[model samples]
Target: MKDMSENERVARAMMATGRYFTATELREQLGLTVEKAAATLGAIRRCKRYITQVIGSPRHYKVKVLKVLPSPTWHCGEVAPPELTDRQRQQIHYLSSVVFKPSRGIA
Candidate 1:
């Protein structure tokens, strides 16, 4: 049998509980550092396939796992970049506008 990755282990634990879990709880249960727990949970939440919901602010978040997703297959080629959100596009436009404005001929 193949060993489970940390992400799969975390997902299984949350799915078994069927309740939201804070980083603190995960850390204690899985013997993980606070940063590791938080990072793992954040990645799971972003995937949206494994996580049902995410609660609380960035500094203190909680996650509820819906199901354990199969590990992603690895590829040996370049991958497409993620699409940018509208907000990100707007931010980029705003920054470019501010940075590349024509200077009023000041000596």
Candidate 2:
């Protein structure tokens, strides 16, 4: 795997296309320990031009910057849910956390 510096990783992560990313997923992709990944994300949020949206009351592990505009919703296909049941939302949220992550961080 190609090694990356913290700054480079943070830059790439900031530019990544996604809704959000968990520190664990970032750690895995960037080859960094969890602690280091978390620290890098934190630093980026603190020092860079980024915006965050809370999926819940302050969703963790996300520092959203440059709003990634979502595709326009169309009635041309099946809709998943208008209002997800609690259990379904939980499942969706969990899977989402895993699928989205940073491209760089440490080690």
Candidate 3:
């Protein structure tokens, strides 16, 4: 039997639950603080390929098992970047319009 790491254990627990969970629920279940839960969840998501973000909310995620065969040449499909929202576009435009002037003291 192999021992699982903390994050792996968390992922397994979530999988066992067979549903998506919010950070607060995970925190309560794992006896962790909000910040710790969020940080731990974030790290787990980054390290575990099977763990995927839920489409509706940033705080939610789901674990999906994908079986991929090993091959000499295997390439995953590329995903296009999400389109910028109106608020994001306005922020970008505003920032782009601003010009930074070097101070006299700065070399």
Candidate 4:
């Protein structure tokens, strides 16, 4: 399953600095809209992964992986790219609110 929103990706990146995140910290470093920060958190909040399942309310929603799942890494020199699950991308697209409309012109 995929992690949270892109802002969560940013949050993980910022966390590497070893500084606790404040709202302003997220705002400044990630340059994300405040809504995005909250939405990313919401996505994290909804995550059912064992890594994210148990945290206090207002859970830091830290993008930390607790129990790493093992997968076959040596695929005969194949480097598989990670991908967002279809459901996850659907949720991300829903958050982005990007509309898809048919072209408006005579056929």
Candidate 5:
């Protein structure tokens, strides 16, 4: 089997976990520069089968990978989101709410 590309590895990791991630986070996690992170995200977007929409401001985005069953064989390639379960959908709704909650503090 051929070795996984850097983007593929990052994509797999993100897909395994069902949580949103920003470009900055991706840069930090992948040790990439700002430009590289942006490029990488574009690459991921092209390959993602599900969870294609990236919602957020220009600088920040909420991204997640739908849990998918692994192929029968050891197949490591581009990343794609899976069909979301009802529970998963509920979780995303809740998390998105919390993530977008404004902080209440002294101005």
Candidate 6:
């Protein structure tokens, strides 16, 4: 598995709790620098899938987890390219015949 960045770690921790937090609270709880805590919280809040901005002064944010399922048409089996249409097949046939035909004029 890939290693998580500090930002990702902080976001995941916040998401796990699913609670509202402010930048100062993050700094105090995580022992981060004032700027780092504010930056991390700002970055996390921008990711709509993971966090949401709550209505208030001083900017409170809450983490949210969204469930996503694989598309119904998606499959893990072998994949094949789509077959050529009749018009495409005809074009290929014409081009092939033109290229491979005996060069009577040159000969």
Q: Rank the candidates by lDDT, best first.
A: 1, 5, 6, 3, 2, 4
Candidate 3 TM-score over all chains jointly: 0.47
TM-scores across all candidates? 0.58, 0.42, 0.47, 0.36, 0.50, 0.50
Best by TM-score: 1
**Residue ranges of candidate 1 with Cα displaced over 4 Å:** 72-107
lDDT of 4: 0.52
Question: In candidate 2, how many clashes are counted?
Answer: 1
Model 1 lDDT per residue over 1-107, tens place: 45766887889888998889888898998899999998888888887457467788877778888876655544533345679999999988988788776678987
Q: What is candidate 5's local distance difference test score?
A: 0.66
Worst 10 residues of 1 by lDDT: 71-80
Model 2: ten consecutive residues of lowest lDDT: 65-74
State residue 90's C-alpha deviation in candidate 4, in Å.
29
Write the residue-wise lDDT of candidate 5 on 1-107 in tens digits.
65756666777778766566677888777688978877777776656433445678765676665543333334454345579999999999887788766668868
Predicted structure 5, TM vs. truth: 0.50
Q: What tens-digit string does per-residue lDDT give for candidate 6 at 1-86? A: 34555877787666666666777878887899989988977776665435354545555553332322222232543345579999
Error of 6 at 38 (Å): 0.4
Lowest summed-lDDT stretch of 10 residues in model 3?
65-74
Whole-model Cα lDDT per candidate?
A: 0.80, 0.59, 0.60, 0.52, 0.66, 0.64
TM-score head-to-head 3 vs 5, winner: 5
**Model 3 misplaced stretches (Cα beyond 4 Å):** 59-107
- Model 4 TM-score, all chains together: 0.36
lDDT of 6 at 3: 55
Question: What's the true lDDT of residue 42 in model 2?
Answer: 68
Assess candidate 1 and give its TM-score to the true structure: 0.58
